[model samples]
Target: MTQLKTLFFAVTTAALAGCAATPRKYDDESSRALNLARAGGVYDQDLRDSPDGTRSYRKGLFTTLLDVASLATSFDAPLRHLSGTQTFMFNATDIMATPDNPSARPSLIGWMPGSLAANQDDAYEHYVTVVDEAITHAAESMSITATKLTDVKTPEIDEHPLMLWSVTSERYDCGKSNCIIAYNIQQPTYWKTPSYVTGREAASYNIAANHPEEYSRLIFRQSGDERTFPVGEFYSAVSADMPPWIVMYFPPNTVFQDGEPLTYPVLYEQGQQLMFKEPNHE
Candidate 1:
């Protein structure tokens, strides 16, 4: 009788743990639509169908306990609302950094149930503040100036070649130009790593051969629409005492504008009207 009670308690605890660690899924239809329209239906199918996709998780008792343990440690994770850290290389362009700006800000906390639940007590204003602060800091780190433009809308912006955007998280939007220069990292707050890192190499999936120790893995991709793309090389910040943020790196002279090889090097141009060029270049 005592053994039965112990077994039941253990089972219940494990179940609860799994539930708590699991991230809530939200309607990703908009994201899917964007991807399908830009990247194609086949690539979207690969992500949805593959076992190593971002959504796939290892099931069973061991995985459950591991997830529970991870959740405990993850409570102290910085930027709890965001899955990972990102760095933007905006070149003094007008940055529309709002969540609605799909090109500038690919993903949002409200889009994820698990992310929202973690900060349920906080007001919506708090989320906006945090996001704004993050974007500002990211720009500063690269010695680039990012002026937040509240009046401008994202779609109105023209495609600029110098804009080379990168992220190290689960999802990314390549914007209208159909160029992708991003990588994937395991979510700092979640037990599971993103699928792009774990999934097998296929069309639109090329794992980084020499990813650093700090990151789980990295993948670089050029979207289905063939355009003049930049050659991005990955590097890690060497610091003994760094913050827990998952930092993404992009070097200058790599991103180009149109077919012309850059006579001047710059990155992270904001909108169509706000563009970046070297002082001498026309």
Candidate 2:
């Protein structure tokens, strides 16, 4: 009888261990939406047809634990929001010395360019202050605009679809008779690598040679229609540090008018306007 009891206890312990190792289903709509977005869905239909069903697939016990442990560390720093009307001027010196003051040259080191570094540091400090102020102003404007554009009780998720826009660097310009403006619908942020250095080649390689269905590059000619642009010598990868962007060439003498509204179309949303202004100047 003693041996039989011991055997029963061992089997019970093993069964409990197996049960503990199984992951529970995440059935919440938010989790479902997040998973659908991560899987590279471009439209509501794609999300509705996800094979994972309406709930999160059961992960291994170890994998679920690891995800919970890394939650805080995986959070991304939020982007600095600048005002729609604010323009950042390009200053080589300011760019070189930003986020840190240049180290002072040794008093006896006559060969060092200490004064130039000091000047750069000063300019950088001033530029950062200006940028901070602009961000604050922009936030205020955004709040006011949101109030006017949206019903007070409407949730943001219901008002806006799960979509992201690709913001191009203001400095990009090609000398042409007429410049083209393009907007490419991007995969969900979860599908992208966190570091550009590690994933650049894979992201920027020719779409046809890789996951063509996951990416579709669109070009907008001055004629306001979609067209194909030559994918010149393909780059190995995108710069991880840079935001997703679309390149367009403008016609000669076409300057980005200050105070003019910069508009881009929302993917999947037919008649909604996502408008801002060029925040940088040549």
Best by lDDT: 1
Candidate 1 residue lDDT tens string, 122-159: 32233334334544465345333334443322222212
> Best-fitting candidate, measured by TM-score?
1
Per-residue CA lDDT of model 2 for 1-282, tens digit only, reads: 999999997786555433322222333433322222222211112112123221122223223222211221222111113221111111111111211100000000001112322443342333223323332343233231101111122111212211111222222221121122222222221112112111122222111101212222222122112112211100101111111321111111111123121111111101111111111210
lDDT of each: 0.25, 0.20
What TM-score, over all chains together, does every model reach? 0.23, 0.16
Q: What lDDT does model 1 reach?
A: 0.25
Candidate 2 matches the true fold with a TM-score of 0.16
State each candidate's clash count.
2, 10
Residue 193's lDDT in candidate 2: 17
